[model samples]
Target: NTAPRPWGRNSRNEVVVPFCYLDEETRKSVRDDIILAHNHWLRSLGGTASKDSGHGIKFWEAVNKKGDPEYCTLGPGKSWNDNVAINTVVIRHLANTNKLSAPIGMAHEHQRPDRDDYVRYICKELKDFDAAFERAKRADSRMTEDALCNKPGQAKLYGFRGEDYLMGVTASALALYWPVNKVNAYDYDSIMHYPTLSGDAKEECLTNEQRCHLVRWKDPGNPNDRSVAMVKENLTPSKADIDWVKATYPW
Candidate 1:
């Protein structure tokens, strides 16, 4: 993905998709298209940014009020690898809606149209009631077609625990819909998974449709499950995540 042509100082030494190899007019047009998109994004933010100084900032301030100093820095996130810090308005919107991270502001992945198909497939194929509906009940007690197929924001807010597991399933599901292609086998260890909330007292009542509190990648494994433990603890992405990001960006 790299090409050397004295393009400029790329201190990051990141993979460079060589668009400059095109004709001069083509390169200029590509740059112009980027600028046009950027300006359009800024104009969209202007509406909320201008309304009240604290509206967006205040949202973050309140959300991160009790966190550490670095956690409370209210601005665009730092860039890493070849990824740029595009904007913060989307981040603000995520916080406002109670989602941990979703730059596109999609509140939940269970609400995606595709996931409905997945659920219907599960209902038809997985006949083990203890393995299917029972587990589904723990995942989201609401378990209704509407609840599973739509964003149950208020229901989730009052019932589910706001932790890595809760957000992991939805976020990981959302990642599937990213323009990025599938780079590897589905990762049960992905942060976008719900924890095995079986014995947890607080999660005992959550519905499968509401948040069954349990999510998996491709299969449910044996008694001692590492993926289940991963959801409960640190959910840093595994090799699958790195591959997914690289493939998605493909610079």
Candidate 2:
């Protein structure tokens, strides 16, 4: 699906499409667009900031809180990548999806919406999530890497692309991990407790239409049992060798 570029930096790199899905021209065009966009952002931010921050050290920074970026003519991630420009980079997952890393959700639409404030908001949010994750990591290591860069799951607070940070870790040996077991129209415990799927725990109590959404992807338990009935029985998380989630947690 084609998505309209927002008023800010283009997040094309975040798309899940593989190389096969995009031609070389399309990729190049996207990259070029990113560069052009980045440069514009930089120029708009009062040029650059070059200061000798230390012995044999040079700190060159061009920031605009409204739409700060690492390099304006370089590409689309300036707001989130530049020093405290918009959001802080927290790899939602490893380069792959299993693990998780995402830009810490630190931007306040109002406070950071202005050009100057954008930089400050990004900086603040970066500091906020980094500190938050670091602190929580002491108790649970996963909390450090696999957490929303924002206020946990606060993406629900406002309707935006804040949750784009999610990437899949090593794909579950889906065939082996999640397989259809049984479809319950009104069974939340079955779907939620299956250890392989995600659905309303109280789905069994829903009507036909409502129950249909009570999807549950469960571990196949046995890879060889990839039968249609078996998959259909499982329902929401079908075992039809498609869209299966690996049962193993990347951690």
Candidate 3:
């Protein structure tokens, strides 16, 4: 497409690439690319879009306005500044045609691997971004579950199954996220949500932001990628939750 893709570094060869893929990682990446592109596009439209929510084609005048997802208007040009502008126009057409889908909770799936969807685990920790997205994809069936492929960025499937199972997975992967976060977070909240304060209980337990702090990140420099950063907030241990973690998974 010769456009500047997200997470991409264009070379002098004029061969632009996407931060994510479009063939196998196509499904989820469609949304991802749109999200990445729109981060720049939305501002051009005279409105501020959430780095998380705005990363989709829903706002395009086509589907929202005209209807099309495979247009160059949505991608950027060689210049890094051109990506959002190009992708913004492109998504409008995609949105109109019903080709684009939602981004969040997305499953980056493709009918086939564009290059190497089965790359090695990007994080190789207990849980990986490719894995989480893959889990969402497998849970949906549109995505693939080839963990051994060695493509490095492809996703794998993950499910909590139950509180215990999630705790188990979290425990297993804790080695991945723990050493870095500093605190030996033995407590992992799965089932019991943050206690919602109604009456005088408003000041009770931790807020959502506090909870999100527990989730691991691929980027040590930018742990919080506003565009796709999962909400770890209000997802940690409460009094009961803490007790449950201690009793259930004391490790």
Show how many residue pairs clash in every candidate, following the order shown: 19, 50, 43
lDDT of 1: 0.30
Best by TM-score: 1
lDDT, candidates in the order shown? 0.30, 0.24, 0.27
Residue 170 CA error for candidate 1 (Å)?
7.8
TM-score, predicted candidate 3 vs. hidden true structure: 0.18
By TM-score, the better pick of 1 and 3 is 1
Q: What is the C-alpha RMSD of each candidate to the true structure, in Å?
A: 18.2, 22.0, 18.4
The superposed Cα distance between candidate 3 and the true structure at residue 7, in angstroms, equals: 15
Ordered by lDDT, highest first, the candidates read 1, 3, 2
Put down candidate 2 lDDT per residue, 134-172, tens digits, no spaces: 455654565423344343243222221222221111112
Q: What TM-score do all the candidates reach, one by one?
A: 0.30, 0.18, 0.18
Per-residue lDDT tens digits of candidate 3, residues 1-251?
A: 43222222133211122222222233333565456544433343233422332222224322223432233333343222332333332222212111221111111111112201111111222223344655656566654433322222232224321111121122111222111111222222222221122111212113432222122233433444332223132322234333322332221
Ranked by lDDT, the better of candidates 1 and 3 is 1
Q: If both were scored by TM-score, which would come out higher, candidate 1 or candidate 2?
A: 1
Candidate 1 residues lying further than 4 Å off, grouped into runs, are 1-101, 104-183, 196-202, 205-212, 215-231
State the RMSD for candidate 2.
22.0
Tens digits of lDDT, candidate 1, 1-251? 22111222133333222111022233333444433433433333332222331112111211223542121123335322122222222211111112222332222332333332222112121112234334446776866533432333422333432222222233332223222223344344443323344333234224342233333323332332233222242234334433433333222
